[model samples]
Each structure stands twice: as structure tokens, then as C-alpha cells.
Target: MSGEDARALPVEDARSIAGVPDGFGRFWTPYRMAYIHGEGKPRDASDAQCPFCAAPGKGDEDGLIVHRGRTCFVLMNLFPYNSGHLLVCPYRHVSDYTELTCEERVELGELTATAMRVERETAHPDGFNLGMNQGAIAGAGIAAHLHQHVVPRWGGDANFLPIIAQTKAIPELLEDARARLAAAWPAEGMEK
Candidate 1:
């Protein structure tokens, strides 16, 4: 194109064109695209295909795992609602809380509590949301697995980016979060 043709086009501020403020910060997590597109999700609810079941077999770092209990474990949420979001899941690939064995139930509860304490010690969030999404209709991303969400919340953490652009700006990397939480986890037999 000639300079005259280029000059004829309307000029736009780069920030306006990019839909972001000049001083606003961003943490681009392109890796999350796979989850958004439903890639790597299980084809069926079989134990062989369940992520919670598979996580225990891999090393802690590779699995984004922060802590491992006897019957349940804590791992970073691949699609987090906030930074340091974690999930506590029983090893057995059960879909409902009612299905958890007594031992599993006890460990799951303990792990969830431990996750909350660890997040507080490491990140010092203002608050937390702890719950389980029982089924697909209840907003369970992996409805086949019974995992409890441990989401750290802070005042003003909900911003326009998530509302307007459907994007969350997480300041920390998954590995970094895992490392911090793992390191801050209370030692075995020690109380928080």
C-alpha cells in the first residue's frame, strides 16, 4: 500500500485497539487454551481416563501437586478461578461425595483443610471459597471426578477483565504456586 492510502485509514490508539490500558498489567497464559477448548479432557468417566486418578502416578512437579495425603491429594487447578486455586480429590475415581469410603472421606476433609492453611501461609489471601461441584449441571468441569475446590479470594480480586473479556489475570505460574504451597505445607504430624 502507498503512504497516501495508509494515511487515509482511521488512526487508532494501540491501547484502544488492544482493549487494554497502557499501565494495566497482564499475565498471558496461552497454555489454558487447551482447557478452554476441551482438549485433554477425558472421553469417558473411567478410572483410566480420570485426571485425578492419573495425577498420583506422575511426579509432584509434573502433576502440579502441592501435597499428597493417604487417600486424597491436593493439586493446582489447571483452570483456576484465582491464583493458587487448588483441588482436593480422592485417589479412587468416584463421582459423588457419597461414594467416598470412610477413610477417603476423612482424608479428603483433612486435605482440604490443609490446602486452606497452606494457601493462607503462602499467599495470605483475604478469604477462601471451599465447595464441591457434584455434577455437570452444578458446574463441575470434570463431573466424573469428585474434587473439592479451594479458591483463594482477595478484596477487589474480581475485575472487569474477567467480566468483559472472560480472562483472569493470574500473577503467578502454576509451578511457582505449587512450589510455594508445597514448601509452606505443614510437616507430617505437625499442626497448622
Candidate 2:
């Protein structure tokens, strides 16, 4: 039926047809389809396809990188659980933490700590969630590389939207978050 005819129907009848007015409003996030379909996900374990490996090769802005260190780098999560979410990754194309050199391991930890501080300064989140999914079976999206997740959290952020609709509403854009965090990042040797 046409829209006009559909609107005239009773609530019960209208519900039967598509585009009927439902009490709940739609939260359309067409951009999320790219993530759902694994648009940038690597086809293999090759360093050429690994985003973490490729991100460091690109300039900071293009790569969404917040801070670049000697051994590791911090970047904005392409599909973040929240705004200002970051991932710390070693430049080496390693699939596990055990593969990290002493220098890489130290820098990764230091970068994670610095990331938390930067997020606090820039976004002032109430709390944070930090972790690393070990492999594909352990929930790592890109199992070929190892990266630590630094997700900023706030009260009420765990709302029904993610549970019911599987959608997260990020208040800020990735570029804006990257720029703000990058600008707020402490100078080298000043994180202490």
C-alpha cells in the first residue's frame, strides 16, 4: 500500500506492512556495514595486508594514529566500542605477545599507559577498558597481529542500544578524536 494508505491503517494493521510507524525510532548507522562486512580486514597473515603493520607506514592523519613511538604506535580503532578508543601495536608483524622483543614489549606497555593518560586529558572518560584478544578464537578481529585495546568508558555507556540493536553511537568522528588525542598527547619523555 501507499504511504498515505499505510498511515491510515490501525496500529495493529500498520505494523503488518513495512515502513509502519513503530514506537521505537531507527538508529541508522549505514557506515557500520563496512565493519560488519570486514572491509579493511586482511585476507592473510601477510604484513602487507595487516592494518597494524600498514598503519605505521602511513602518515599519522591518514592512519588515524595518535602517537608513534620507536617500537610501538597508538591509533584510533577503526570500529571502536566508544569514542576515543585506541589500539597499541608493535611495528613488527607479530601474531602474539610472546613474539615481542624486550624493547617492543616495554614500549607497548608504556604506550598503553600513555594512551590512557591522553584519553583522560582529551576526553575525560569516567573509566577505561584495556585488553588484548589473543587470537581469532579469543575474539581478535585481526588475528594475525597483536594489539592492545584501550577503550574509554563512561557511566550509562552500556545501554540497551548495543545489547538490543548491536549498534554503538559514537559522539565524535574518528578524525576529530584522532586530532584531539594527538594534540593532547604529552611530549616524548613527559608521560611520567
Candidate 3:
């Protein structure tokens, strides 16, 4: 068809005329734009505005915290890539892993393990992705503070949405996830 004819056609007709394949779906996730624009992000990397530094001061629900330890804590990811996504972070505001003290390092590891256990109990994910992005160059959204991500993965969880539209559809609310994880957290060995 000519360019003028294509422009005058309805969207569906235009697609058909262009021989575009059918049966594709669109998942609109406009909310993700906030994360892209850094809405609710700290103004700077300073402790005064750092999310990791401020989260501990708030109550569990407000902070989306699932567990709290002396040196490190577990909190829900505000912009989770998947449901039950959590972050284990030190109480201190330090960007590099080397900046963590021995106690902080140990607690961070323990908290991350606990986070995985709790997520498994609560969400029953088939697998997990755990690691940290060190700096801005390394994809750390908050490069001022160090945090370990614990993202639960299930079969067929990977899809075209994130790749095609840069959007992830989280199936649960953060509060609900926090509550479920907190309730499932092992109580026997948890630090006060």
C-alpha cells in the first residue's frame, strides 16, 4: 500500500496491510516511568537522603523491612524486578563491600540467606538471583550505599515485557510481601 493509504487506515487495518504478525500482547506499565525518572529516590548519596540509612529509623511496615539485625537489615525493593524481591544492606552508609565491617559483612550474608529462606517459604519461587551492583558504572541504582539483591525467580518468569518495554509486572504488593516474608522468617536464630 502507498504511504498515504497506510496513514489513512485504522491501526488494525494498517498492521494487517503491513503484514505484521498477530497474537502479540501489550502490557502497559506506565508506573515504571517513575523509577526511570528517579522519583522517590534520594536527592544525593548522602546519609541524610540515603534510603538504606533512613529505612532502619522507620517502623517495619513503613520501611517495608522484613527483618532487622544489629549491623544489617532486610527490606523490600521499592522497585522490585519480581515479587518478593528484597535487599540486604548494612546499617551504615557505605558504598563499597570492603567498607563493611566484619560484623556487618557476616550479618549481611546471614540476612541474605534468611531472606532467601523466607522467600522460599512464602513465595515458593523455583530459583533465585542474588548479587550486588557495586557502583553507577556497575548498575547500582543507589551507588552511595551497598546492598545485596535477592530476587526470586520461577519457571517462565522471564518474559519479553522487560526486554521489549522495560517493564516488570510485580504480582504482589510490597506490604503484602513484607508481611509474608516477615511471618516466614526463621525465628529461632534471628538476631534481635
lDDT per model vs. reference:
0.83, 0.88, 0.84
Which stretches of candidate 1 lie above 4 Å from their native place? 1-29
Better of 1 and 2 by TM-score: 2
State residue 12's C-alpha deviation in candidate 3, in Å: 10
Query: Where does the lowest 10-residue lDDT sum fall in candidate 2?
Result: 18-27
Residue-wise lDDT of candidate 3 within 1-192, one digit each (tens)?
A: 765676787766766763674745444455677878976566555747787888999999999998888888899999999999999998888889998899999888888877877777778999999999998889998888899999999999889878987778888999998998888887757532
Which window of ten consecutive residues has the lowest lDDT sum in model 1?
9-18
> Candidate 2 has which clashing residue pairs, if any?
none
What's the lDDT for residue 148 in model 3? Answer: 98
* Model 2 C-alpha lDDT per residue in residues 1-192, reported as the tens digit of each score: 766676677767767575655776555676778877877777566747778888988999999999999989999999999999999998888888999999999999999999998888878899999999988889999878889999999998888889999998999999999999999999999977
TM per model?
A: 0.83, 0.87, 0.82
For residues 102-192, write the lDDT of model 1, one tens digit per residue: 9999888888888888888888999999989988899888888889999999999999988877888888888999999999888876734
Rank by lDDT, descending?
Answer: 2, 3, 1
Residue 97 error, candidate 2, Å: 0.8
